[model samples]
Target: MARLAPSFGHLVFILSLLQVSVVCQTPDNVNSLLTNLFANYNNKIRPVNDQSLPIVLDVSMFLFSVNAVDEVNEKLVTTGFLGLTWTDDLLQWDPTLQNEIFIIFLPQKDIWKPDLVLKNGFKKLTEMGGDFYFLSISNFGDVYWYPYEVFETRCSIDITYFPYDKQTCNVTFIVWSYSADEVIITKSSGGIDFYEYEENSVWTIVSTDSDIKKDSYESEITFTITLQRKPRYYVMNMILPVVCLGLLSLLVFIVPADAGEKMSYSVTVFLAFAVFLTIISAELPVNSESTSILSFYLVLQLMIGALVLIISSIQLRLHYRKSSRGMSKFFVAIVRIDQFLRCVKRYRLCCKKDVTTVENFDKNEEEQSTELEAAIEWSDVTNAIDFLCFWFLLLVNVGLTMFLFLYITGS
Candidate 1:
């Protein structure tokens, strides 16, 4: 009985060692597993026997950040992580041998992968990430792929309501040449996810959504992201200055014509408006479908400024001209209009003492004097004309500015 006990103890010890060795075994190499799964893999053909067994392609995106929205180039640059998954029945492995594995290979690998690509990409697809660019596989023959990419894509921009415009941009994924019978693209479980968001200086992300469209020949997965422009900078730098200049232009009418700087001041303000127009043009897109309301407002102000320049020239000429030889009736009409408006009442008060001391200060001379005061009466006529025009132009400027900017911004 003692000899039998020793032999049994030795046998039990040997079995325990064998179990430990198996438990601590090194996992299988991913390459060896791939070799076993795809011993007869054909990269050129679909990994299915029946064409009716459509290759289901699942796609998802994690938007990490927005790099830039280039208005000049009409492109949207973004950085994000994209994941793809498909199943290949031919690559199944026994879970008892190896549960799951993740491996990465160039697109030119031996195993079959769907030919999915961005439809509106502006650059070629190139690997840009470290360890995260890889493929995952389960024992049930399901294949997963994820890659991080940063690139630009074409986008249509509308600047009609600019600085307050909402833009919708899309990133679409589709099978390059594969048909519906072979490759069927669909959104993954969560579809689209925003992993992180950072506030932008010039634009704000409003919302995001996804949709899938299938046709007889192909399928598509598109992600829509909406963004709005930050208007504070535009209002402060571009809008406010031009509007203030418009108000300053009205002062050209109030400046006394005899000051000798009225024409020069109008010219200076005209040039200032021109400079602001150039600055705004540089910031806005040149080839968009619709022009900005601000551009229209600038042009309107420029036209009014030009008209005021012409009027200032006329008023200055009338102030200094000494020839009243043949226009007696015109001078008489001018005196009547100025008297009716009471535009020169303060000037008369200052000259009252001089009039009382004159040798022949006739009371009727003040009421019926045509030739006696032709030069002075013409000057008053110019002032009366400027006063009326000043109030009219101011109203037009204010009303037009309010209608164009505020109404469009709210809309």
Candidate 2:
């Protein structure tokens, strides 16, 4: 019994020792599992380095070129954000992330190579960055402009392997936004009464080869605008208003010279021109190297005003001369001078000899010494005014019409 008890006791001690060994072994296994889990997680997070990856990987970027042509002294220009020429899809902005960008200018091989560095240049861009590059002209204004874009990588690598990953990726393309065109002005084929010219526009690209692939992307542009009417200066100043002035002057024959309407008509004609003058001057340059057609018309209007003033003065002198016949010869000579200017040598005022321009009217039917005297001849003054007004007004209108036609037709 004692022997059996001791054996049983040994067995229990042995089982306890085995349990301790298992517990100790369990901690080591747990530690190993934890280390393996962490190591696998990190391996999945990072991609293979240069050894596994290659440098010659595919990338998204833009490619561009400039074109020149004969239709205009203009060029077609384009821009690419990334260094790629093609996009997987035609419709998309530059990829937010990209590998490269490039710009190419296709000038005519025959034409002279421009001194791009002197004015517009790509030097600043090469100085700026390797990836976000620029190759266009720059004014640079004055000081430094290109301290940031370009750089030389210090790390070295094999040339044969391309550094590309197999995961999903994107590529983008860029296009030109703006270009400058030239204008052409040449003589028209259709002959004109006077010399004239016409203007036209077009867009063009320049290249020596007949087939330019880049020009296919370019589109044509045309401009359309509105036209306005210009007013005539000569007729507005000299002719149309003269018809009314003549009508007003004719009233002198209908009413008495002593009545108020004659002086009013003369004054109205003068003031009407003053109003026209104010308006015309506002349109014309205040000072000019050569006088305008408007100025010529105004001078004629001034002469008409002077004639009216002369008639008014003569009439005033005649009225007082009815009481004092002292300067009768002088008044007669003045009447003859007026007659010649009016274009009717037989023109006269009342019993006076020939006179021109509306000299004066006969006594009114109500005021005449006799009703017969009221109907006395006033034909002298009327004839002179008719002849002069007809020719002067005709000249003014014809000149204005021709001027307007020539201006509008570009003659």
Please report the candidate that would top lDDT against the real structure.
1
After superposing candidate 1 on the true structure, give the runs of residues whose Cα lies further than 4 Å from its correct spot: 1-25, 28-32, 99-110, 124-132, 189-191, 322-376
TM-score of 2: 0.30
lDDT of each: 0.74, 0.32
Off by over 4 Å in 2: 1-255, 324-327, 332-411
Candidate 1's clash total is 0
Worst 10 residues of 2 by lDDT: 161-170
Steric collisions counted per model: 0, 33
lDDT, candidate 1, 1-411, per-residue tens = 555445888889998899666654344565567667667878788887686778998888888787888776778988887778788777676745653243324343556777777888888853333443456666666777776777577888877887788888888877877888789888854345878756678887888888988988988888888989889998898888888999999999989898888999999999988887887778766655778777788889999999999989988877777764554566456545545444365655223211112235464666435434534445665776576668779999999889977777896
Q: Write the per-residue lDDT of candidate 2 for residues 1-411, one digit (tens) a residue.
A: 355446888899999898666544344553443343235333222112332321121112121221111112111222222211111111112211111112112212211111111112222312112333333311111111121211111111111111110111111111222111111111112111111212212211111111111233321211111111223443465444654553443334344455655667667767776776666555443323234444554565566565665666555444433332233344333434444564444463334333212322454533432322322233433333434444554566456545544543442
